[model samples]
Target: MITIEQYVGKWSENEDWTEVRQAYAAQLLIQVNKLLEAAKKAGIELKNNPNTDSLISGTQYGGFRPQSCPIGAAGSSHKQGQAVDIFDPQNKLDGWINDAILTQYGLYREHPDATIRWCHLSTRAPKSGRRTFLP
Candidate 1:
């Protein structure tokens, strides 16, 4: 499981990752961990290797995006600390994840075609409200 620092990363003025740390460190992190554990139990191995600019070495941003950071769209779940992007360079995750599993986890992800290198999973539903929706 990723730490709150890994989720918040080096963004905005919140260098301490205190912004929304309560939620991400507690609830969001648990959800992400359980989902990942389920995936691992299914024989899916997610490598911890993504070239991201985060404080945590050898880790990518788990979800939270500071407003000062230029990443996701405005009003994005990430900015609200409700999204997580798991590194999936091989695209194995996107291929393996289906609507049933998403429903089971109560999570949503960007469509496979839209997110090529990483699996963008979010606690927030997309505008389309699909388990896997277009970004």
Candidate 2:
């Protein structure tokens, strides 16, 4: 499981998103942790946050991005603290996960094509209402 600090990125590049992310950390943890547990149950190892003390060591996007981050849209769910992009170096999680697994966790994911080496998940519903949606 990812700590709130790692999830929120303690030393953010902008520093402005730290406090804002902290405000959403607790609630985000409740949602993201469930999915992490689900992944573990599915035999997936989400040990992406190896550097517990680092600023942006959470994932490829490095969790809780500020507006300045170049990864997602300005209005993306990540900015709202409603989404997380887990580090799946070998694409195992993305390839293995199915609709049933997503429904079991009450979470949704971006299409595997867009995800590549990372898996983008969110508790927020997509406009298409799909378990695996296109961004």
Candidate 3:
């Protein structure tokens, strides 16, 4: 699991964004931690896997993408620090579409389409309690 300090923007290029990201860390930490826990419970190891590592680790993803980062959907939960895109390096958990554990942890997958493969979950509260998948 990653610490709040790991949730930073491009500090080297934009100090302002770094400050913003840090200030928002407290609000985001719990969510990120819960997400990580869910991943672990689902048997997804997010360590040094080539496809599942962080950008700082020389991979496209892992967790905590800042608003300044030029990837993912614009105005995404990722930018708000409430979401993470998990790369299932070992194809574990048979995909997160039907995982009851995720719901038990109060995490929701952003995409409902199983073909997307990777687990994209968020801590953002939904508009209605009837649904857990985002549009």
Best by TM-score: 1
Across 25-69, the per-residue lDDT of candidate 2 in tens digits comes to: 566667667766777897876655454433223444557766667
Candidate 2 residue runs with Cα over 4 Å from true position: 11-24, 49-60
The order of the candidates by TM-score, greatest first, is 1, 2, 3
Whole-model lDDT values for every prediction: 0.70, 0.70, 0.53
Estimate, for each residue in 43-135, the C-alpha lDDT of model 1 and write its tens digit.
Answer: 987777546543122243446666555776766777777777878877888888999988887888889898877788777777788998987
**In model 3, where do residues sit more than 4 Å from their true spots?**
9-29, 38-47, 51-58, 66-70, 93-99, 112-117, 126-135
Model 3 per-residue lDDT at 55: 17
Q: Which prediction has more favorable lDDT, 2 or 3?
A: 2
Ten-residue stretch with the least lDDT total in model 1: 53-62
Candidate 3 TM-score over all chains jointly: 0.58
Worst 10 contiguous positions by lDDT, candidate 2: 51-60
lDDT tens digits, residue span 8-57, model 3: 52432444345555545455556556756766786666554454344123
Better of 1 and 3 by TM-score: 1
User: Model 3, residue 62: what's the lDDT?
Assistant: 37
In order of listing, the candidates' clash counts read: 0, 0, 0
